[model samples]
Target: MAQNNSAFSDSSVHVDVKDYYGKRLQKTADLKTGACIAPAQPLPAFIRDALKKVHPEVTARYYGCGLVVPECLEGCRILDLGSGSGRDCYMLSSLVGEKGHVTGIDMTEAQLELARKYMDYHMKEFGYKEPNVRFVQGYIEALVEAGLEKNSFDIIISNCVVNLSPDKKKVLEEAYSVLKDGGEVYFSDIYCNGRLTEEIKSHKVLWGECLGGALWWKDLLQLAEQVGFSQPRLVTASIPTIDDKELQDLLGDFKFVSATYRLFKVPRGNTKSCKVMYNGGITGAEDVFQFDCHYTFKANEAVEVDGEAASILTHSRFAEDFTFQPPGGSCEPCNKPKVSVLLHTSDCYDCVVLS
Candidate 1:
């Protein structure tokens, strides 16, 4: 049994998690299950080089399930919830550039200490003018106490940590609160196809290993919608296996997947009535782009999308990267023909008719 000796919280779940990350686990090898590890996915060379530069000590303590990196991060402000050992923070430091900043928050002091230990070293190694990444010892479920300002960060990321939070809904709500209007919450965590029983939830070993704490996929979707993030997009998913037979038996028939999802804090509109066209504007995505699991936009191709989807591309950080058209496929004249022509006067052909 893991004893919670941390000063973070009184809840048994929080105590166990703090103990698990702060004491019981020292390295990835100490984990009893493969749940904390992400499935094999080929990494791009730039990302591979960034991972290679991370301190060995940081990698040794990492226990995440997936690569939750999103694009357009050059000058974006990023926050990592439960950023153990600052592994992702350091990686993001190389990507966010000198003008950008990365902040990591964790409840465990031991992890925070290790993360802060190499701050200067990493800053010098990355060739930055000054330190751009900082670590804060705090709870993911409560960000205000950590002195985080609302509507501040451009992007918030968590890797296999949200499942460990005793208050997942609060964690998400806080995430939404701290993010800028066009910002996004891109994260990777464990999810089960079915709900777990009280018995499983109470198991200390299972919870620490991240299996017993998994949220049902559908419930996670519902929770996201409940908190104003009405549209949650799944980026990647893979089934995870438990090598320990004894623990696997306790898991019973529950199927768990390490899934990465991105929820944007944009206006919730019925994207059902919009048409979109990508102008090959975004640097790397000049030809075609996969907006989510359901939508794809080809360069110069006007694709029909719902109002919500249109709002996602136009109102969010991706707005300048693409052009938007209104519903009914009509850039034609209304009561005022000259007004219609004025609205259509652009190389991108943005004809979104104001209702």
Candidate 2:
């Protein structure tokens, strides 16, 4: 669902992307590549059951590359950019509980229409007196103009949609502007190991399928920093399934991966050496809680973490779920947090300190 014209100077690519997602690719199976598939790891029982509650019609049109669901979503305000057919929005609605709200925005009217059609049904199914989810027609690049307010959302999620925007930086900026200080944008999309050629960038089928429009992994990190989000956490990552021989030949060893990255909007702090304790209280993850691919905190155990990790646990929405203890004999907060583990192939884990 990620389509944009900025990768190339041509405007036709943009038109093709709208046309393909709006009318051409009508279902999940309509996608020819592995861009929209689910994760290799099996989802937990609660999440799987919640997904089953999503109307089949909505899931039929889902084109996301990775799982967008993050931990501790209860009672949080969420925004889903490029929320095609409301698949993830509805699932989030259930996770955030009745008090929480979800807003979905997309430029494609046809997809939005399908998402809107099931609102009443979902509200009734969730046993809510009032509906907590709604779909709006708009582009992801201009969220403020689309009626989204500044510093309003606790979490924002997008599914394979950022690649389709020509102004990827603007999209990130708007996302940052709308997020609360502790809010985070956790999205799943396709990223290539290297930059693509102009010919590849302009390929209509490739662009619409999320291949040709993929951002180089390095470029994505740079964009995050430029927009004031440094040291993005790699939540999950996987190699894309490029089964099409013709497409494979066109790619020519340009490795692509489906990665989910989370960027927090809090002040960039030095990595403080600290320890955290998980109380075994979260709904699904009681015995152990996986913060990202790198760290998992077990119940009643004191887990040592770098400054960035400590900030994530002590300052963000997940703060209440953890108890933080800073490094011994040091009142100075960690300014430059560094992670020594390689959570993914070719990933840079330099934790940046904000000014």
Candidate 3:
């Protein structure tokens, strides 16, 4: 195939991404896992059930980097960026229920066609009366160009697809634009352990698919800030295992980390806070959960009488959401050195500010 030689052409960009992914999608069973870290939780049983009900041909062509929407989404209007073959979108459609909708955007006609063809089958399998998901052919960077409105969706989702875009900043901007004021853009994608070089960005096979042009973590933070969203929150993590024999020579044993992002457009000047007490329940739980999403608190961050006291946790950057007077009239004797004094820092962002 010849190149499109337009001013937009980077000379390095090659091939319709659809053909590249279509082949890769078809051959995923034996495909080498090149530093692609999968999600911690397995795909939801509802989704796996739906996939099984769909004909084998459809499942054979389902290829994606990770499941991005593990949040408790009972009724969210979700927009999936670069939703190839509508796999994730259908899962969201089921989770969001009949009142909700899923919109999938992709640039490849072949992939979009395949996704659209399954609309009836999926709707019936999920026992929905109408098609709750739609597919649009376009780029993630220019989502508004395809008729999306500002501040409309409850949840904006993406799966290992943003790295394929030539204009990721614009993609971040557009994502922030379409989200309702409190809406969040939840996504999972590949990130290099270190910063990426321009040469890696231009790798034809890598960029043509979704592996080569991943963003540096710091750059992603800056873009989220630029887009008027709070800093992204990480909910899960895994490391990618590379398999490219040739690229291995160039990028030797480089680690790839996969993480989920929850970026929100916080309300103006309104800082929120949550009093977190570790119940030793969540992952790698300690005797108490002391770490804030952004920074780790020193031991005794939360005042506990016996490793299990319920006191309002306070941070300098956060307003005490719970207003409780001490057990006495002021600072109570119940505090009897049972808890240590903790100092809070002022360098907190608004995203987690609403903790």
lDDT of candidate 1 at residue 114, scale 0 to 100: 96
Give candidate 3 misplaced runs (Cα > 4 Å). Answer: 1-16, 22-25, 30-32, 35-37, 44-55, 272-355
In the range 1-355, model 3's lDDT, one tens digit per residue, is 8875532322234244555775545545534554333553466566676456564555555655666754435666889997877777886787778888999988777778888988888898889998888998776776777788887887888878877776789889989888886677878777654566767766666665455777766677888878787656565445555566777665554455665666766643343332232223322223333222333322323322211112112311111222333333332222222211222211122221122
Evaluate all candidate structures by whole-model CA lDDT and list the values in order.
0.80, 0.80, 0.60
* Native-referenced Cα lDDT, model 2: 0.80
Task: List per-candidate RMSD values in Å.
Answer: 9.4, 6.0, 8.6
TM-scores for every candidate against the unseen true structure: 0.87, 0.89, 0.72
TM-score of 1: 0.87
Which lDDT tens digits does candidate 1 get at residues 1-355? 8885643454888889989999999889999988898652456577778888899999899999988678778899999999999999999999999999999999889999999999988988899989999898888888876888999999999999998877789899999999999899999888876789999989999998888889987788789889999467765666676889999888887777787788989878655556666777554455766565556567777777656667777767888776677766663221211122232112111121111
| lDDT digits (tens) for residues 89-135 of candidate 2 | 99999999999999999888889999999999888888889989988
Rank candidates, lDDT, best first: 2, 1, 3
> What TM-score quantifies how close candidate 3 is to the native fold?
0.72
Worst 10 residues of 1 by lDDT: 346-355
Off by over 4 Å in 2: 1-11, 329-355
